[model samples]
Target: MKATHNPPTDVQVTPADLLRMAALYLRRHGWTQGTYYASDAPADNPTPPACVVGAIGIACAGHKVEHFADLDTDDRHTYLDAIAVLVDYLDDHYPIHLFDDDGLCIDDHTSPYSWNDDPLCTADKVIAALEGAAKEWDRLHTQGGEQ
Candidate 1:
């Protein structure tokens, strides 16, 4: 039998990058379109509820909505650490499905909206979602996927 090679298991990604990816995913899937806030505005004003849900959904799947408060921390240094914990949680749980266009369920692995080859919504899932969104944006604007 020929030897089989396995890819590395550990994924290294920053929480901010993950958030950016989530934002891109949300925009691509019609969650943040036409929703704008001033650059200096507070988080609550600019960050949509769906984005929060998506972040929580990805970080803590199947968790009750009320539990979000428990996850909040006062430690300034641990802010990104909190996000890292959530990203780690996504390694095992199905990511929160944010796309709801045409009543299509994109989160379901069996649904036509399911784009990734794998079922779990890990880092690859986020990346895939971002890539799909970029493609859709490109198709719409004819920007040739620049920037």
Candidate 2:
């Protein structure tokens, strides 16, 4: 019986790298909300518009966001950690929607995807969050954290 050879996964994709990749992907292609790319989004060339998290998943998975879930668990964990960093940043600095315009707090600990999907969450903000996460990891690495 012949043994099947599994193809190697994208093991080298790190959180910091993933953040930067997602940021750049958003910058080049475009940003969207509510879905992993627009419903009418094209397959390639245009590279379909995606939200912040969508971009991260797409970037890690490469080319298509559908492939993101197919990645090994380790890879998913590493990349998801990066996404968490962005969520943390949003929960800290953004969350404009969480406010009811009366300066009252609401929906505590809401999912970051809600923030990402917020109309107030612009592409620039998402890009900044991604960059911030990358810088944050970089700082940690410099401060005796994991590499």
Best by lDDT: 2
Query: Each model's TM-score?
Result: 0.26, 0.73
What would you estimate as the lDDT of candidate 2?
0.76
How much is the lDDT of residue 128 in candidate 1?
48
Clashing pairs in 2: none
Alpha-carbon runs more than 4 Å astray in model 2: 1-11, 43-46, 66-69, 96-110, 145-147
Q: List the residue pairs that clash in candidate 1.
A: none
Model 1 quality (TM-score): 0.26
In order, how many clashes per candidate? 0, 0
Model 2, position 73, has a per-residue lDDT of 85
After superposition, candidate 1 runs with Cα above 4 Å error: 1-3, 30-147
